[model samples]
Target: MSIEIIGLDHIQICVPIGEESIARHFYLDLLQFTEIEKPENLKKNGGFWCKAGTISVHIGVEKIEKSKSKRHPAFIVSDIEATRRYFEENNVTIKEEIPIPGVSRFSCFDPFLNRIEFLEYI
Candidate 1:
């Protein structure tokens, strides 16, 4: 038998315990993702679910330790420049990425230091 991998169902990003509100502010307000109800059974676990287009983001709570890593979720945006400016206007920390031919991209850190990439094809 052969195994086939399917598409991504969701991406989970963790924030410190009791910091769901902060996560909500960033994902719901700043990023403008729509909130989705969690399963009744899963409500016991802190965090919330949200989606923008086909991307579903699950913000969960945990005790986090600072780390320097390049792991992030890259989101395809309609206007990269506008997205960059929006983050700047909101005081979000933006990271400049190496130039890629035919693509405009940059990264920014959320309130919890989770890096997110925004990109648009040129």
Candidate 2:
């Protein structure tokens, strides 16, 4: 299937509130990716952008009337144990430990109670 598109372009995720610093700390500091700030007009829409390898993730926020941030994103890692240990060192809260049939992943919550899953794809 040789066409115009070769591979992935980017991935976008949404956050409930638009607190970008937290996102930077987790994505840039704790995890990975280089922080990319959102434009003034885009900031009002909530979130920022980051680049890792050839992929980009757009973290957006929403303003709901009630509680928000119930959604979570899953990340694929090379080593599950190593990543889990890192999370432990950071004192991150571990929510669930389940191995997917194909991929190995452990879901957890951040300081803001946002669910995230770290998995090993082998």
Candidate 3:
């Protein structure tokens, strides 16, 4: 039998200082992410979790000073161009528009300087 991995489970992000609080403000307050409760054992890890549609995003704080957060999250949407227009209307700087042959995608940075991609499944 072949392995049947259907879709992505979740993407975990490690933030050393535990920006779970701030993340809530941005993703929940501004972006309207639904806050989720982690397992009891994971409570001590110092992180926040959110869910949007079928996507699960978790941000956990690590205890390393040397290692910094260097990755960005790509959230899925129905329309890429419309989202870009929303960002542009809000004065968000659109970094680049990449046409990947048959995909609808755009790249930009958040106020915190995090690279973000808005993409839609073709």
User: How displaced is residue 76 in candidate 3, in Å?
Assistant: 2.5
- Give per-residue CA lDDT, model 1, range 4-38, as digits (tens): 98877899998889988888999999999999999
Top TM-score: which candidate number? 1
Off by over 4 Å in 1: 1-6
lDDT of 3 by residue, 24-60 (tens): 7766765677989999998887788888888888877
> How many residue pairs collide in each prediction?
0, 1, 0
Residue pairs that clash (backbone atoms under 3 angstroms), model 3: none
Q: Using lDDT as the measure, which candidate wins?
A: 1
Q: Considering summed lDDT, which 10 consecutive residues are worst modelled in model 1?
A: 64-73
Q: lDDT for model 2, on a 0 to 1 scale?
A: 0.72
lDDT of 3 at 62: 67
lDDT of 2 by residue, 1-122 (tens): 66697766666665558566787788778877887666678766767899876657787677633333657666778798898889889998666665568777787765455677778776
**Could you tell me how far off, in angstroms, the CA of residue 97 lies in candidate 3 after the best superposition?**
4.5
lDDT of 2 at 45: 75
